[model samples]
Target chain A: MTSYVSDMRRRRLLAGGAAVAGLAACGLWATAARAQASLAMPQPDSAEADRIAAEFTGGAEPLAEGLALDLPALGDNPAAVPVRVHVTEPMTEASWCEEIILIADLNPKPLACRFRFTAATGSADVAVRLRLIQSMPIRAYARMNDGRLLAVRQEITVAAGGCGL
Target chain B: MARPPRIWISNETPAPGEVVRVRAQVVHVMESGFRVDAEGQPIPEDLLTGFTAMLDDALLMEWLPETAISQNPYIEFTFAARHSGRLRMVWSDGSGVADEAEREIRVG
Candidate 1:
């Protein structure tokens, strides 16, 4: 009888070990799948970003506007930059205001931030804290509901250096 | 028992469908893992590593943090307000102790 009881206990242990191994394999498979998805979604290359801009502007050349983008020219701390971008436009549903996008052209992810608002906001004022991988041109694209894309750019100098590869 | 940490939101009042800024500062001793005592013994890593915000009962945001986060970590996120509700914020440390605080925001 004692031999039978010992055999039963050993069987239970073996089953539990098999269950744990199965769970670990499942977890690893899930992680690998996610990594592959990210790898497949290639980062937007410079040419692609430029194409997006050109198509956005409807053949009109992108020119720098006098819009104010508040970021320290020389960021002492690269961790955070309090950025504010204000466009000189009447905030009306039909009056050419649509969405504001913040782009860090040199950051690993060039598309840094985006904002969409209704006419209730009353002002095309956007404020947010953003991360700067390094010194680069921070581009702001204001896409109007009418499909006209306005452009603006500002260069910020980092005290230490730009966040680089 | 220690003092209950205080938290407040600093930004535009929340309204339905409006993206409002939220900032919080909690006062607590966050010990980094690399610290050494006077006798040069390695201090165990005990720091706040996670945070979550719930609007009434639904979770709005959850954060899994890293050691790179500076001491007395600060987090900022924008959430679209759906209705008038209470914002409950909870923080936890590596030692498994948790602290929670709540604030009310009116969203029309």
Candidate 2:
């Protein structure tokens, strides 16, 4: 009879340990899910892109000159639309382009890419391919080493049946 | 093993202080992880996350790209050559896998 009682107690202890392990596993899964959710891309919106740019520029309006954003006015293929960004200003140690950011207003994730440059680069010219969901405006924001912000925007119309299908 | 990427430069023999164009392309599906497979499984996002160009150990430029970039990514940029050296291009994916290509350029 004593052995039976001891067996019951051991079984109960084992079940309790298993429950704790199960709870830990659940907690880990929840943490992973939250992390993934935070990384999920937000929907496309030009206003959202503007907000991001404003934040980057410290709530200041970026000058729309000295920077050129090149893209086809009519994009034949949205899946691989070509974009080129250039800052006409000279890149010297005292005044150089610090970073260039590309934003596609209609893409599910508007922030496409960012290129960082140092005085060693000598110039701020970058070309890249992006995915566009529809007809929308694309913007390029450039930050100079001297803390000046410059931006340029271009509108492109894409035909039906592009990326994000 | 993945295939080696293709890299192209517009001016292999550029004069000193001249700006040379560099272009690179890599073949990859660039899965965005937003799609569901036929078996109801979420497709994991895989993308080229970083690119850098170095000239004889001197960093020239670096790019941090996002998933919005298209498949078989193509990138182009220009840098002024001050001297003759080996220009190395490296591209890395989200999985920490990196592929590199190099070109020798002569400058006066």
Candidate 3:
């Protein structure tokens, strides 16, 4: 009878130890996952977004609907995404365009590319290839000759595996 | 008194009225000489820093590169062709080494 009682106690202690070890393993896994997520800049912060906005707008608040930026529907290759920006307004001498800038909202550095146009260029069709860290909002801002700032944004879903990761 | 370099040009046959794509790659070690050798002595720097390509007496491209370039430098450019002639490639290094090579092309 005494041996039976001792065996029951030993079994209970073993179960308790196993439970503690499993909990510890789970905790360790969670901590490691959090560390990895922190190391990745999968999203842009408010300050970075503001800096990108100010680069072309010169601190003036940009009107968010005048320019149109087109991005890929699905980007399986995160290394390069084909982007094109088209301005509907007529480009003329008096209607000259100043500059166009591309911003990747989720990239570690949001400022991607910039192009300054002259009055001689009558069309605002700019084609370029860019690297996307992940799926994020892409923005295009146009500075007009009249000194007005126009901006547009589009969201794209980027698949896993990209450059600079 | 080194071996004569060999230069090859792609796009031997170009269109009648098209920009001729020219790609030239040469074999040479562009040593900066700043790094120390395994024996703890400063190695002398030797590298090609300047290169010029001409087509029938017309300068097509000229470049000034730093020592950070790879051992073999590859250059690409465009030349508007009028007729067939010899393309000359000339290069010089900081170590006082100079070399030249040539290739012929037919411009349709």
Write down the TM-score of every candidate: 0.45, 0.81, 0.46
User: Candidate 3 on B9-99: residue-level lDDT in tens?
Assistant: 4477766434465555666665445445445565566666676667677655555544323455554444445567787878778766477
The collision pairs in model 3 are: none
Chain A TM-scores, per candidate, are 0.60, 0.70, 0.69
Report the Cα lDDT for residue A78, model 1: 56
Kindly list the per-residue Cα lDDT of model 1 for residues A1-165, writing each as its tens digit: 999999998997777676677866545444443211111122344554565456556678644663458787676765455566766655553563556666666554455545554443334655544445556677777766666667887787765632211
Residues A1-165 of candidate 3: C-alpha lDDT, one tens digit per residue: 999989998997777676677866545445443211112254545468668688668889877766777778987766546677756676654785667777777765566655555553444555444556677788888888899898888888877873422
Q: Model 1 off-target regions past 4 Å? A: A1-52, A161-165, B1-108
Better of 1 and 3 by lDDT: 3
Better of 1 and 3 by DockQ: 3
Q: Local error of candidate 3 at A113, Å?
A: 0.6
Model 2 regions lying over 4 Å from their true place: A1-44, B1-3
lDDT of 3: 0.63
lDDT of each: 0.58, 0.82, 0.63
